[model samples]
Target: MSGLDQRRVLVTGASGTFGRQLCAAFTAAGARVVGVDRQPGSIDGVPVLGCDLTDPATVPPVVAAAVDRLGGLDLLVNNAGVGGPAPAELPPDEVVRQQLEVNLLAAWRTTAAALPALEAARGRVVFVASRMALLPLPLAAAYGVSKRALVAYADALRHEVGTHVGVSVVYPSMVASPIHDSTADAGLSLEGVSRPEPVQGVVAAILRAATARRAPRDVATTRRGRLELAFARHAPTLADRLVRRTVATRIAAGDLDAAPLAAGMLRRHRDATG
Candidate 1:
């Protein structure tokens, strides 16, 4: 699991800002990558296959095709996800279901489909969860729930795979991505959104997790990210409170609609203290 030279990798949601960056990074690291997304597009000279992840019938075949094209997969990056800002009028249940479909169910189906290949390669599975998974937010009930379920799924899969195949779940905080755009479309402000780390940062982490000799069940790449994980593990109530306060502050400032506001605040705070 050290070198990625010629190893085959599958990255879901390749068209995404993170996904595309991840595919490029993996390719640069010498892995033969197959990018999967709902849109057909190429990344770093890698093939991008279109597949509707939410549709059970469509996901398996796409994975199968990716396996055939790459010969076999040594790593799987489940990065495709959605944060539906259900209109203020939508029922809570409907909102929750949409998030579950894209975030949890899709990840499950892809992992299940790729099991044999992952087992044969003794490779790794990387689940891209979020800080919300560790610390829930008020309006993001569905997104938080789906991420929590994903975390559980990753944990269970790690046990099921044992030492034969590695599994790692990453919890990234407020990454700059199209997720904000989606949220805004649903009527939420983009303020207090954390600037996304370079897509390469996440890609590097995924590569490290995949190639590591000993993979852990979870990895948080940032200080804040790690702290959030600790809070979730030891004092979930505390973590919840912190998140609630942060969101509340944003709402009160009327900056919630500002794209990249979260990132701006984080950067400003860091700069001031540093």
Candidate 2:
């Protein structure tokens, strides 16, 4: 676990921007990388498996294939996620349920399937969560709820694996990625976006956290990001109020759109405070 060299790594949603980058970065780090997506193809010579993560039955076999191909998994990156406009007027319960199914349940299924291998290798699991998980925003009710669940899931998983497997959750701000294209169709915008943290940074952090004997529960790009973690710990109510104010300001400015604006505002607050 000291190095990615020869370590087996699996990345879900490998066809997407972040997932593709993650696969490339891990390969560059000398890990034997396996990419899984709903698409059939390969990236940078890495094999890509076509699997539907939403189907509970598909996850275990996918993990088994990855283990078979790589011998065993040292790292599992739960990077697959979905978000789109769900009619602002929709019932909160319905929207939240769908969001949880895709963003939270899918990750849970994937992690559960990979846990034994991870425990066997005493490896690591990385969750690519959003800033919304920490701070709630206005229009993104479902997305926010799902991310919050993911944060809870990661925390619980960390404790469950205590001193056995490493668990790291990353909360990234707006990044220029195709996710914007999909969400934009649903009234989202990626304007004024923070530069996507080089995929290498995330891969490196995962490698470090997993291989290292002890890994931190979370990793963020900036001090402000770190500060959000602190605020979440010390003053959750104050944090919620601060987030609400920022979302209000964005709405007033008309710079925020319906889809991603809430998440965008939370990212801005994180950046400003960090």
Instruction: Evaluate residue 62 in candidate 1 and report its C-alpha lDDT on the 0 to 100 scale.
Output: 92
Cα RMSD (angstroms) for every candidate in the order listed: 6.5, 5.6
Compare the candidates by lDDT and give the number of the best one: 1
Instruction: Report backbone clashes per prediction.
Output: 10, 1
lDDT of 1 at 160: 85
Candidate 2: tens digits of C-alpha lDDT, residues 185-245 = 6554434322345555655555555566566678774556678767877899998877666
lDDT of 2: 0.76
Per-residue lDDT of model 1, residues 1-274, tens digit only: 7888999999998888788788878888898999999987787699999999999999899999999999998989999988856422236766678789989999999999999999998888899998778676555667888999999999898888866788898877776677767677645644564434555566666776787778767877676667768988899788767766676577556555453424544455447657
Off by over 4 Å in 1: 86-90, 93-95, 193-196, 254-274
Instruction: Report model 1's TM-score to 2 decimal places.
Output: 0.86
Residue-level lDDT for 33 in candidate 2 = 92
* CA lDDT of each prediction against the hidden true structure: 0.79, 0.76
